[model samples]
Target: MSAPVCTIDATGIHVPSYDDVLAYFQTEFRGIYGSDVYLGNDSQDGQWVAILALAHYDSCTMAAAVYNSYSPTTGQGAGLSSNVKINGIARAIPTHSTVDLTIIGQAGTVISTGIATDGTHRWFLPSTVTIPPGGEIIVTASAEDAGAVEADPGTITTIGTPTRGWQTVTNVLAATAGAPVESDADLRRRQKVSTALPSLTVLEGIAGAVATIEGVTRYAPYENDTNVTDGDGVPPHSIAMVVEGGDAQAIAVAIASKKTPGAYTYGTTAEVVTDRYGLDHTIRFFRPTAKRVKVEISLTALTGYTSGIGTEIQTAVAQWLSELAIGEDVRYFRIAVPANLDNGADSKTYTLTDMQIAFNGDPLGYVDLTIAFNEAAFADPADITLVVT
Candidate 1:
C-alpha cells in the first residue's frame, strides 16, 4: 500500500483520511518488521498502530481547518467573524422590537417614566415625556426583552405604569419586529456588499453603507437617474430605499451622506438629518410592509415518521420564508428544500408529496408569489400547514 500525506496544491488543501493514515502505518510496520510477522486487526501491534495513526490524522485535519479559516466562504463561527472585520463590519446582535405608542394625558402632564404592555410583552418608554398643548404625544417604546417581540395595531393599550394624569396608551401601527443574532451566511453576504462601499456607483455605495448599520437585517436601494419618473414611481434623479429592522435616523444619515447632490429621496418614512453646517434635510425612505405568507405541505409518512417530524418541517419552512431579502420573491420550489431538510431522520421519515403557497389567507396555489419591492414576506409556524399521509 502507498503512504498518504497531507498536501496543499493549486486546487486546495487535502488532508488524509483516518483509513488512509491507518493503512500507511500498517504498510510501514510491514516494511520495518518481517513481512511474515502477524499484523491482524486483533493483534497488539495492529491496535497500537491504529491509535497512533488516529492522532496523526487529527493533526492533519486541524491543519486543513486552520487554512480554510482565512477565507470568508470557508470560515465559520468565530473565524468568519474575525475575517469580516477587514470590511469594517461585525455580526449584528439581536435587538428589541419598537413601536410608536400614542399617549393621551392631561395638558402639562409629566411622565418621568412609564411602561406599556400588550399582555404578552412589556414595552419601556423613554426617561421623560411631557404632554404638549394637544394632550396627545407619540413616543417610541422598545420591547423590554430582545428578539422578535411583536405588537399589532392597538394591542398595546394597557398602561403598565400607573402614573398621575396618564390616561391611555395604544399603538396605531404594528411594532417593528426584532431579529436574531446574525448567522454566518448573512455575515458573508454583508461582507461581499461592504466591499462595494467605495465602488463606482453611488447607489451601491449607499447600499453598502446601509448594510453596516446596527440591527439592519435587510435592505434594498433603487435609483431613478433618468429624466422622468421610473416604473416603480420613483421621481427622476431620486433614490428609493426599502429597509427593515434598523434605527430610522441612522438609515437617513447614511443615505444623506452617500446620495448624489441635489438628488431626491422617495419613500413614505421621513427623518430629518443634520448636515455639517447644521442644516436639517428631511430624508425619505420606505419601511418594508410585512406580508404574511401561507404555506401548505403534503407528505407521506414512511417507517420512522411521527408528529414531531411534521412540526420540524413547519419550523424549517417558516424560517426560510422570514429570511427572504427585501423585494425577493417567494419561489414555489425553494420552500420544498427546507421542508425536506437533510436531517438524519428526514429521508427515512417521510417524502414530500405536494407543496403550495399563498398570500393574506388566500387559497393556496401552485404558483409563485411576486412580492413588491417595498413589501417583505413573513411566515409563522402556525400558518404553515403540514398534512401527513
Candidate 2:
C-alpha cells in the first residue's frame, strides 16, 4: 500500500518535499514571536509527518474543516457556550477563603489588562463568580503581562483568573451536631467542576507549539486536587480550580475552602507599623480564609403542625433554598412555647402534606427533596397541608 500524503493548510505533497509548508508556518510564528518553529511528526504526533489529525478524520475534508487534533489534550470549544451554570461546593475556614473568576474566548480578540474581545463585544473574567462560606470580597484584573502582547486576533489570554476569597472569620458559629463541614473528597469533587487549563496565562510559548511545522509539543491535561488543612470552626478542607471546563465557579468554590487553612499577612505592610496613608485601601487588604459547602434544597413537610402565627412552611423553604445557594446565613423554625406544649386546647394533629425540594441556583435541572413532618408534640393537633414546587 502507498503511504499517506503530507498536507498543510490544504495543499498535499509527499513527505520529502514538505519544506514549503514549513515556511508558511514561519510567517505566522514571526508575527507572534520573533522566531520560533516546533513542528511534529505529523500534525498529530510531530506536526512533521506521523499520521491522522482527528482521533477519527475524513480525508476528503481536510482544509475546510477543523484540523484532526484529537488527543488527551485537544481543543474542545469549537462552539459557543451553552446555558450551563456549573455547580460545585467548598468548605469555609473559620478564618478566611478566596474566590477567583476568569472569562476566556475560545476564538476571540485580545485587549490590554485581563479583558479580551471578539472585535465586537467586551468580556470580563468569569462573569459570574462567588465565594463560599459567604462573605464580602474585592475584585480586579490586569493583562497576563505587558511584555507578551502580540496575540492572535481572536485568541489573546490572561495570566490567572481574578481571585477573591474571604478571610479573618471572627465570631465562630456553633457547628452543626449531626453534619459537620464537608470531607476532603467532597472538596475535590467541587474543584473538578472548574475549567482545567494548562496555564492560567495562555503561555506565549504555546503559539510556537501550535504553529510547529514538523515538530510537536506534548500537552498535559488540567487536573484539580483537594488540599486538606487545619480550619478552626469548620473541619479543614481546600481546593483549586482552572478554566478548562470554562468552570471558574467550581474553582472559585474550591480555592476559597482550601486557601483558608493557611495563614496570610494582613492587608498591611510587613513592617508591623500601622499605615495612616492607606489602611482602608480595599485592594491592598487580604480576606480571611473560609471553607465552602455544597448545598441542596429539599423542603420538609410538617405534619399536624399549623403556624398559629401564619407561618407558611412552603414559602419559607423556597426562601431558605435561595439563601443556601448564595451561601447566605439562614435560621428558621420556631417551636411552640412550653405552656402550649402537648396538653392544651392548642394541642392538635398537623400533617405536613407535601414539600417540593429543589436547588436555588439551578432550579430547572435538579431533583426535588420530599419531606413529611408529623406533629407528635401536640394533643389532638389540627392537621396542616402544605405544597411546594
Every candidate's lDDT: 0.86, 0.25
Q: What C-alpha lDDT does candidate 2 achieve relative to the native structure? A: 0.25
- Where model 2 places Cα greater than 4 Å from the true spot, the runs are 1-274, 277-311, 319-350, 360-389
What is the TM-score of candidate 2?
0.18
Residue 232 shift from truth in candidate 1, angstroms? 1.7
Best by lDDT: 1
lDDT of 2 by residue, 1-389 (tens): 12234455544222422343434444454556554444444433244222222211334344223343221122123210111112222241121111222232222232233333323322233343343222332232212322111122223232332333322211111111111243343333332323332234332222212212111101111112224332211122311111111112222222322332332312211112223554421111111111211222232323454545123432333323322311123222211122123233433334222222222233322233321110001111112223322
The candidate that wins on TM-score is 1
All candidates: TM-score: 0.87, 0.18
Q: In terms of TM-score, how similar is model 1 to the real structure?
A: 0.87
Q: Quote the lDDT for 300 in model 1.
A: 92
Displacement of residue 156 (Cα, Å) in model 2 is 24
Candidate 1 stretches with Cα past 4 Å from truth are: 1-4, 100-116, 125-140, 157-173, 342-345
Looking at candidate 2, the ten consecutive residues that score lowest on lDDT are 372-381
lDDT for 251 in candidate 1 is: 87
Model 1, position 244, has a per-residue lDDT of 80
